[model samples]
Target chain A: MGNFMEWLDRRFPATQVWNDHMAKYWTPKNFNFWYYFGVLSIVILVLQIVTGIFLTMHYKPDVTLAFASVEYIMRDVPWGWLIRYLHAIGASAFFVVIYLHMFRGLIYGSSREPRELVWLIGCVIYVALMAESFMGYLLPWGNMSYWGAQVIISLFDVIPYVGPALSEWIRGDFVVSDATLNRFFAFHVIAVPLILCVLVFLHIVALHKVGSLNPDGIEIKENKDKGGIPLDGIAFHPYYTVKDTVGVVVFFIIYLGVVFYWPEGGGVLLEKDNFTPANSLQTPPDIVPLWYFTPFYSILRASTADFLVVLGSLTAIAAIATPFIKTKRSNKIAAFVGYGVIAICLFIFDAKWWGVVMMAMAIVVMFLLPWLDKSPVKSIRYRSLPFKIAVTIFVLAFISLGYLGMHPVSALSTIQAQTCTVLYFAFFALMPFYTTWGKTKPVPERLT
Target chain B: MSSNEESSNGDSTNENRSRRRFITGLTSAAWAVSAAYAAVPLVLSMTPSARARNAGAPVEFDFSKLQAGQMVKVEWRGMPVVVLRRTPAMMAGLDEVTELLADPDSADSVQPGYAQNPARADANKNEILVMLSVCTHLGCSPVEKLAVGPDPEMGEDSKGGFFCPCHGSKFDLAGRVYKNVPANKNMVIPPYQYLDENVILIGDDEARNA
Candidate 1:
């Protein structure tokens, strides 16, 4: 056995790579429930890809046949219903895990300084996953799928000059037809999945390079022993592997419950309109996107023509001026200028274009997270009361926006959505000021 | 340090700066060339092929066998186009229901230049009403309620039109959506031309208009 081990080590760096990433890799000892989501995300990703491959075997991409083929998979193929449900439910689960994982990062300041590349790579994975889910949603060829594609594709029409032509080019015709469906299937199955896998690999590689942040947000590596082993760290293989197994078991319990009993998630995960075949002439009355996208959708819906211009100019000025505004006096002046620009834009442009800009900025703001945060401490635990309150408000605002996105648009809901949108942007934009305002707790030398 | 050594150090620093600049320029040029080369296939792939463009070709229908007050559905580019032969009563109903429509003048909606009137029908063929069956509110196909009396869904005093089962949006006999319904705009009128008195070509309006 020793001779074989030596031979294999010469052939491949199997043990060395294992020790670097898993066996001897040091993880913080203070990791809690929030840490499970990172692993859970990987599990869900694997589930989606495996079941997606299985679904491709029985699925047809043609416009006339796609709907029936999905139905056939549900009814005819042996345990095919389970596979389809797993894939469908897995899509929702992926977002659930990813959102929680991101929230964990927010609270722990995992996106700070040394780990900025990891966060950026994770964001890339997020964008790619969204594209993957979107293209996959079209494969069912349901009413919601067809119209959702139509509405989203039409959003490009808001662009000047090349808008209409660009949309036509995207659809491969004047509208969502067989060509659009075929191309989307190719992308969903082959192109996007490949990109997603590559991004996921990069995300993990970047994370390992930076090591994991703990709940205390203290650098464990700074307190290394003579042998260079971190004082507050344990081997990742034995400690975290066993701990993650428990998380996996608990996750599967809830996941299987939804997969078997409530795969539709009460019309949030899978909409009722999606049961019917795609009809180009007939559009379902309420064209709300899937649940994961509702927050941004609500923001998009809130932008009326005049309001759009105001918000657009404000967001543009703030995003552009933030990096350059160095001194406190300049920041104050910039804030005043931002307000003046908003007031000016109210009379300049219409709300329709601004709403589009607002929707885009919601995602774009996340890329600036590492810089926007100005807290002395990395974790929320050590932050002052106001910072904690701000985080709570931001989470609530996000939840409210998501809830508003799922319902029919109305005056009351629209007002709520607009408020939430403002709150959401304010959380990021005001982070530098608010995060530095409060008194911070001193971090301990070691994990308690 | 000796003056000779200092001068050589300055020369080496200059050489390093120029060398670094050269490498940066070369790398940027390589990236630009690669990006331009790669964009060719990607841009070309995005263009609509001849087959896709041809998918919207005009579909012809012979309405000679259709009876008055009857509607038949034809498939055009994977969309359902309804051609209805309106009765005299239905024709009169179109003008009567003008007050209850969201777009009575067809001002806010799209149709060919010749069909941009209250009736939303081709100027030459008023009796034969052709429109895309999609509802403007959300896109469900509204079912025809062509009777002159009350509809269970649209309430009493309801004139003949179409009713969307999904959202209860009502449309008049001329495909104009009712006021205050989920749908806010009238049904779309496809670009169409009369091939002859008895034949119509859906999706082709250029020949007669030109």
Candidate 2:
């Protein structure tokens, strides 16, 4: 086996590559529970792909047959129910892991400075995954899938002259139909998954190049031993690999629990309305997107037509003025102007378009974090008290927005959603100012 | 450097540069043409398919069996078009509720020219109301609450109309949306005309074009 490996190593850099990334690669010894999500995410991605491939064998993409075909998989094919549930639950689990992984980056400031490329790649992967999930949701040919696509696809019609035409092109028809279903299947099964895999690979490669940031915001590479390994670092294979297995086992227990007992994720992972096949003429009384998208969906619903223009102009002004406004006094003046603009726009424009803009800005604002944050320290542990409070409030706002998105729209819920939306953007927009106001603790020279 | 040597060297270099530019331009042009040709089928394939186009063809339904005040739904182009045979009282009720509607004049909404009257029905045929069943807000179907006077869902003082259960949007007998609903516009009146006394055709009301 050693002789064969040596021969293979001469032809390909198999051993060298493995040693570089795994066996000999050094990671921080102080990695905690949050760090487990990154490895768990990879495991979920593989599960989705394997289960998804098996599903495609039994699944029919044609509109008329799609609903029945899924039923067939659930009943007729032997143990096909297990595979379907695995794939369905896997999608939700992927988001769970990904959101935690991204939160880890946020709290630890893993996206700071040298790690920006890794973060950017991860963002791209996230966007691709969203597209993949959306396309996959349509394949079931259920009522929610149909109407959800209809509502989302119609969002393009707000763009003015070319809007209607562009939406028509996307649907390949006047409405969501067989054509849209077929095309979405192609994208979901092949194109997007390929892109997601490539982006994940690139993300890891970039992370490896920069090395990992620890909880204390200390660079382990700065304190290397005589053998070139960091004093506070351990080999990734023997140390972190074993640790991640424990996380994986624990995760699988919960994952299989959902698969066996609560595959629908209590009407969140899979919606109840989705059981009914799509009827284009009769829309469901209330249509809500999957849970993962509810946060942005709530924001979208909060904007009325007139408020949209105000929100748009305000967002534009803030994004543009970010570089120009250097002083705290100027930021305060801009904030006052922003409030005034919001007040005036409420009286004039509609909230419909503004809701779309806000929902989109919710995702777009995340990409600006590496630059938006001007904090002196990297980790939240060392950051000032106010910064921690701000992050906690932001998380609360996000979770609340997500919860609100799942329910029927009401006047009170709309008000609540709007307030949370404001907080969500303010967290990022005011980061440059508030981040600089606080006193940060000194980072340790090495991992404790 | 000698002038003769510099001129010869410059001439050869210019010739080589032009040759390179020519090849580059030629290759780019060929690639552009090929790409355009390749995209033609893809673009054409994206248009509405044969099944989709055929789905939009005019549909005819018999209204003879449709009783007065009864709404009959027929599918045309994959959309539900509701035809209601309004009673004399329902037709009279339309005018009384004009003050309660968002688009009382139907000026901001789409309908055939024949439906421009206060009744929003065909000229001289005010008893028959034809409109798409879809709500203008988010396309949910509005249930008929055609019972006159105070109802549980709509409110007291409600004259029978359609009330969208999804968003609480109300529409009068003439399909004009009530004010302060999530739906801003009146229900769309599809291009429709009576082919005969018993049969009605949707998607081909020539009276508007004429």
Candidate 3:
């Protein structure tokens, strides 16, 4: 104990401030990928909140001034563009990291067994983040914001009873107006952040209670000897702290680089049209969200094939509820499904070309996953690098197809657009086959 | 004893070796290239940047530079939306549009004040007709079908107005939409009561109040 005290004095004098918590603290040994991201996510949350606070100091929320004020910040204020870009990119980046982090839980079977509540809280955080970004997107008050809301609100019009009324109720008036803008501004700056912060705290508390999972899918308790030492657990300080610090530093350079430099130049980091004020009269060509949202945006815009639209919407919602999917599942199957998810993710990241090329492929891939595996390990031979790469490229082709399905050009023509849209539908409808048949990839022996 | 004292430190030595190698890699040419590229724009934005100046600067259009029927382009808030004078044929086409438009009077619709007068623009009636090239329906920019006759492919604005090639939405010379076309409103008369002989500032309105 005295030696530990001496070490604390030497290493983390800051530990002295939290004597009660730090005194009992030992490094968690079996901590895994799932653990690292929670910490990273928390750090990023703090970053987003801090940068957001600075941005709000200059942002104007009134309808008449909102667009011009953003421009004022961009043109007049020093580094205002940087602050706005950080918040914008940070919002998108936040979702990317959180999605990856959530996928980590699905990969390691963190969603099941004793940690279900932890997984649930994390899901809650995901939902809250979506709402926060939605509201924040509106605060910019650009044509994209106004029209994107116009289109999305138009979706409620398709609802059976009281649809128009519901849409109007959602907007708080006839159109996306001052009341809506002011209210969205309030929620973006204050309400959502407050809720998001609280949810993050709860997510952490839940994670800490169950400890964290490791890569091997083994429990740390299994390695413990008669001695109290966590056989698998390692001290977080100096060890993982340094490791995570490396990631944080790299991320910091990225964050700072984006914030200090060309903010909204587009094709990356900042959106170009977003630099202009919200003009209702003049619409920017090709309305789309920040890239992180394109997958679902592509899905939502795929077709008027209402059933496929419903299915696509359902699949997107399922992505959030994925944690709940494993509660009753066998572990190996859960992990295999998880891998299927990862394959889909890789395609989403790289699939840039437009048309049926990508969509036709994802359908086949998803359909094969189930039939490929009656059990997890039986699927091992399917994971050979070449086949894996084929499945990846094929699925990537399908995402590209789905993306092109959104707004095909005149040279591309209506038939071309419809064909791509049909293929997107075909992909979702045939999910069971391509996924089940792809390869009998080996799965985990059991879920944790 | 600490692990350092008890062990031969093979793992520690290996870890240190790897960390050094990693740090060494960080100083590679790739990092320099990435940093250079990122810094170029950052440096440019802080200076006399093109995007900065082009975004809100007062755009000058030389009326004399344009031939009576020829169109000249100018930037409005960095958009390539057009502004040009109405030729006599386009001006004559406006009379036919009154009965067909939703708000034929241009009442409380396209613009305010200086635009309230018929033909909705300033003196030198044939000189300037300012309108963004954008279409109100789905936001596609309408291409000018700048001709005189009602040819087959000539849209409803066949007489001469902006025609949205995307959805076939059409607007007249005064930027008024033809009835039942995809565009319901006139092309937004961006807030401008012209500045003087040839210059217009887009960000601030200089139009005379009625």
Candidate 4:
């Protein structure tokens, strides 16, 4: 029987994927709530993929009839309604979980050194997820799918050549037609799944390779007096599993809270007119994206022209990509300068843009990170005030965006959006100026 | 002693005759249920209740009224199905799609247990084959596109597939839709068991013989 089991194990690959190299892990004590987000993100990704597969069975993809078909699935097909909600809510949970997970990296300096690739891979996964979600949003074939694709693809039109023809080719017919719908369906159901699966594999590979980072910024890798056995680290199973289970439950509560009670996640699900088929003749009354995107879209919507719009768009990209730059160990003075710039960006963002400017500034810090960490902290006792301040700035900016997103006045919304937009870009554009002189630890060799 | 033996013989013969009559009654009872489907329903007013519409329960139809080449709509619960008697051309056209159908043998498609063989409906060139019109792709009603036309967007090789009026997806006459269409499976074919020459009941166990 044992030999049979061994043969079975060899035939299937799960044993290799989950055992030996992966199962041998240690988690430090005092690792905080932030440590759990990475696992939580993984959990949500699996849930989304499973639900998404079931949903594809019932979804329609033609421009003429996608909306009504979704309604049919919701109304008639057995258990289909549940599957649709599971997928929609699952998507929102994915973004929320990832944001927290990203925060964990930001707070603990997990993006530094040997772990930077993990952070970079995480960023790559996030970008791929954004593409996946965008393609998915198009599949429902509602007015938003039509207009959103119209508006977004139109952004591609900003490119110098192959703009109009490219858009025409993309739509397949003169406009978003049956061909476009079917093709987008293919991309959403098949192409994105393949890319996402690959990215996820890489992201986990990077994460496992680095072990984990803790809140104290201390390595739990020291040995006992004999120096043979681990003194602090614990195996990830049974130890962190107990902790992650709690995190999982909390994540589910929030996930269900959004799915069951307020499934729209604030007017995003079943966007009222999205029930209607795509009609180029009429536009949706309010053209907001899913809530996860409103903060960035708000930035885009705030500026009215070509150049400013370009700036706003660039600012948003720069914001999401900032961590890559801010964690570098090369430029202490500039890193410290980046610190001040980040804080000022946040304060000015709150006072001026109502907070978007701060988030944008923080994102600039992220891009500069790979080149910024000149700090030579040899001991674990050194403090990082500038990074702390930068993180604080980021939080303030995030709050500002969320708050202004909820604001009723159109003018105030536009102002808040534009204010954050400028500070956001300025933070990135000004990064080279700041990173030349950041602060750092003295020297570990001469530690007192 | 001789009188007693004669009385006993008389009783044995009477019992054997009674037993034969009972066996004959049981055979006719089974036949009556199925025969009711095959031959009973042409008498319009004598329709069976919903309870009688069991799996492969013979459904009675008045073929007397249905026009050739035209369709008659029937309801089983809330779902709608079309009962059509194919013209010689329609049957000939079905042959054209023999290669395209994922399961030309009707391996996985639903039908009456009695109609297990190829062509699904019991007997070849039969007047009726029941089909559920709902598209397997999301339950949208499929519009019939019987013949090839100038669909500029459809590929040159595109045979007239039922175009989903909702999404411009197309399916052939045999109910085999294209690969890229939203639907993952072909339209459903309901089970129909035939009982008799003119009086056929739909949805019965014609498979009892099989």
Candidate 5:
């Protein structure tokens, strides 16, 4: 075995790669419960792909046969229910793990400075994962899946001139039909998964390039011993690998519990409307998307004519205050231009199109987090009181929007969502100011 | 730091360098042309096929059996086109609710030139409304609440038309969109024409215009 390993090492960097990534890789010893999500994300991705492969074996992509085929998988295919449940439950678990993972990064300032590329790649992975989940959701050919695809695809129709044609091209027809289903199946099962794997690989490579940030936000490399190993760091292989195994065991207990007892997650993981076959003629009384997407959906639904005016007024105030703020001359000019453009769009375009824009911007904003945050310190442990308050309000607004999206829209709910939408954008827009406003606690030298 | 370093040996002349660069540019242009050629079929493959397009050909429906204050749905281009025979009360309500509509004149909405009025119905058959059932906001079909009084789904002062279940957008009796809803424009009226007193053709208006 030793001789074989030596021969392989000469041909390829077999042992070298292992040592570089695992055995000799130095990670901070003070990792908390938040760190488990990274490993759990990988585990869920694997579970989804494996279960998806099994589902495709029995699944039909044709619109006519697709709905019945899923029922067949549940009733006839041996242990197919387990595979289906695992895939369905795993989809929600993936989002739960990903959201927590992103939240952990935000709190620890993992996107700061050198780690920006890591965070950017991770954001791309998140977008790709959303596409994957959306396409997968349509594979069941259920009532909710049909209308969900209809509503989402129709959003493209709000674009200026090319909107109608763009949507037609996307749907491969005038409306959601067999062509749409077949193409979505192809993308869901093949194209997106391949992209996701590549993006995840890039995310990890970028992460390892800038080493992992600890809860204390201290760089372990800054204080290496004479032999070139950090005192507060440990080998990732024997230490983190064992620790991640424990996380996996605990994750499975909760994940499989949902699969066995509460796969529907009370009409969240798998919606109750999805049990019936798709009918285009009649829409369900209250059509809601999956839980993970509700926050953005609420943003889309909140953009009325009055909401546009509100947005314009806020932009006008910011533009008026731009000269007084201590920013670069170029930044002031850019802010003026951006505000002017937004004001013009508010006048020219319809509110529905702006809703689509707001929904997309909500996700696209996260990609700019590295630059948005101008805090002197990294972790929440060292962050200002104002920074913590902003984060708290942002999180509450996000949760409120998600809750609103899952229920039927009302006059009161629409007003509430519009208010939350303002708060959501304000958190990102005012981040630099609040982060630099209050006093930060002194960061310790070592990870404690 | 630059491509000049590779040619530091001074073995290559300027003419030789220019010729090499020209070839490289030509090769890149050729590859771009080939890629564009390859991509045409890929993009075309995703658009509506001949079969799907054929399915969208004009639909003819006889609405004689459709009673007043009742609506019938017919499929045109895989979309629900609702044809409603409005009662006299509904027509009177359409005029009264002009203030409540976003586009009462249908100036910014899609319809044939003849049907671009408050009723959103053909000129000869002004009491009969023909509009695409799909909501202007998202594609979900709105449920009809054709009454003129108070009710749920339609607000307390109903003046009822259609109610979009997905986003709560309301429409008047003529499918004129209510103000401040997610839908900005009125519901679309398909390119339709009356073939007879009781029969109509949807999805084509060429003969009527000519």
Candidate 6:
């Protein structure tokens, strides 16, 4: 073993690489429950890819056979039901883990200056994961899958000039037929998964580069001891690896519990409508997207011609109020320009198009969070009360939107969703003001 | 160094640098052009194939078979096409909901010029509506509520139109979208022309003109 290690060290830097990433790598010792989700996300990703690979072995992409093929896997193939359940439920679990992981970042300021690229890469992974799950949802070729693809692909049609042609190109036919199914299968199985693996790899490398942030959001590296080891830091391998194992074991008990007992997740993980074969002539009475996508889906359904008028009036009010805020000259000017541009867009584009834009913007806005926040300190512990109140309202609005998107549309729900959509944007739009507005507690020299 | 010597040395270096820059620029342009050339077939391969295009040819429907206030559905280009023979009462209902429509004139909606009127039907047969059954919102076919009174799917004071169950968008007898629904425009009216007094061909108006 010594001889082999010596030979390998001359050629490959195997030990060095291990020391850099795992064995000797120092991480803060103050990690808590919120830290478990990062490792859980990796666990779910690996579970999805492995189970997904096994599923593609028995799954057929043809529209005629796809639905039956899924049923066959559930009924005929050996242990195939377990694999299918894992993959299906794992998709939703992945989102749950990811959303919590992201919330951890928001509260802890893991996306602050040095870690901005890590957060950006993480946001991209979230988007890619959504695409992967969306395409994977279609491989069953069930009624909900067919119509879901129809609605989502039609979103591309809201573009002005090449909208029709672009959507047709995406479908590879006039409708979501066998051609679309086959292409989506190729993407779900190979193309997107490949991109996801690369992105996850990049996300980890970026995270490691900046070092992990703890709940206190202090840089442990800044207060290193004589040997250059952070005083509060512990070796990641023996410390975090063991701690994360406990999290993984606990996560599996609950995950496998859902898989074995209630894999359908009460029609949110897997919709009841998807059990039937697709028919182009009919649509399900209430077509809700999966639970993970409900918030953005609600945003898409909230926009109307009157909604545009509401948005225009809001923009006008903000534009009128821009002069009263005590800020830099440039920020006030930027506020006016932003409101002016939105007001003009309300005239130039239809509300249907704005619905698509807003749905996409809901995700895109997260990419700007690191810059949008102008707080003097990191971590919610040291942040002001206004910021705390804003975050509370934002989380409440997001949860409400998610719940509302799962049901059929009604007058009350539409009004509720419209209000939530405004609050969702207001969280980011007002971040610069509220983050810098109130009194911040003095950060302690060490983790509490 | 003397000024002349420095100038001569700078001139030779400038000539060599310009030569290298030109070669690099030319190579980059060639690479970009070839990449674009390779992408053309790759991108075009994802469009509708020849077989799909061939299957999308114009379909003829005999509208005379439809009774009053009844509708017939046919497949055109993999989409449902509804040919409805509107009763006089249903035609009059379209006028009642005109004030509540986003585009009562069919002005931002799609149709051939001959079908762009309030009825959204060919001028020769104004009561016969030939529109794509696909909802303008997300392409799900709308459930027909052609009755003249209240409906459970529609409201108590409903004007009797098509209702999309997915997102609650509504359309009148002429296929014009309602004012405050998720769908912004009316259902599309496919380009069609009369073959006979009771038959209409859907999906290829220019071919007959040619």
TM-scores of all candidate predictions against the true structure: 0.81, 0.87, 0.53, 0.56, 0.96, 0.94
lDDT of each: 0.84, 0.84, 0.58, 0.59, 0.92, 0.90
| Least accurate 10 contiguous residues by lDDT in model 6 chain A | A279-288
TM-score of chain A of each: 0.94, 0.93, 0.68, 0.78, 0.99, 0.98
How much is A216 displaced in model 5, in angstroms? 0.3
- What is the TM-score (0 to 1) of candidate 6? 0.94
| Pairs with backbone N, CA or C atoms under 3 Å apart (clashes), candidate 5 | none
Give the best candidate by TM-score.
5
DockQ of each: 0.21, 0.33, 0.03, 0.01, 0.74, 0.64
Question: What tens-digit string does per-residue lDDT give for candidate 5 at A73-169?
Answer: 9999999899999999999999999999999999999999999999999999999999999988998999999999999999988888999999999
DockQ score of the complex predicted as candidate 2: 0.33
Off by over 4 Å in 5: B1-8, B11-26, B195-197, B205-210
lDDT of 5 by residue, B1-210 (tens): 466776664437888778889999999999999999999999899999999988878999999999999998898887888999999888888988899889999998888888888888877889989899999999998989988888777788888799998888999988899999989788898888778778899988887868
Task: Output the number of the DockQ-best candidate.
Answer: 5
Which residue pairs collide in model 1, if any?
A282-B139, A283-B138, A283-B139, A283-B140, A304-A351, A305-A350, A305-A351, A305-A352, A306-A351
Q: Is the docking of candidate 3 incorrect, acceptable, medium or high quality?
A: incorrect
Give the lDDT of residue B33 in candidate 4.
79
lDDT (tens digit, per residue) of candidate 6 on B1-210: 699898777768978679878999999999999999999999999999998877878999987779999997888887888899988888888888888999999888988888888889877789999989889987888888888788866677777889887778889988999988988789999988888888888997875467
* Candidate with the greatest lDDT versus the true structure: 5
How do the residues B1-210 of candidate 4 rate in per-residue lDDT, one tens digit apiece? 999898777658968668778988988998997888877444332232233233223356665566656666565432446566656565565567667555565565555554444344556445355666655532334555544545533345555445543223456655655543334355676665555555545544455558
Residues forming the 10-long window of minimal summed lDDT in candidate 6 chain B: B150-159
Interface RMSD of each: 5.5, 3.2, 13.2, 20.8, 1.0, 1.3
Instruction: Pick out the ten consecutive residues of candidate 2 chain A with the lowest summed lDDT.
Output: A345-354
Those runs of model 2 whose alpha carbons end farther than 4 Å from true positions after fitting are: A305-349, B1-37, B67-69, B85-103, B117-119, B135-185, B207-210
| Superposed Cα RMSD, model 3 | 18.8
DockQ of candidate 5 is: 0.74
lDDT of 1 by residue, A130-235 (tens): 8888888999999999988876776676677897798888888877888899999999999999998898899889988889999999888899999999999899
Q: How close is candidate 2 to the true structure, as a TM-score?
A: 0.87
Which 10 residues in a row give candidate 3 chain B its minimum summed lDDT? B44-53
Candidate 2 whole-model C-alpha lDDT, 0 to 1: 0.84
lDDT, candidate 3, equals 0.58
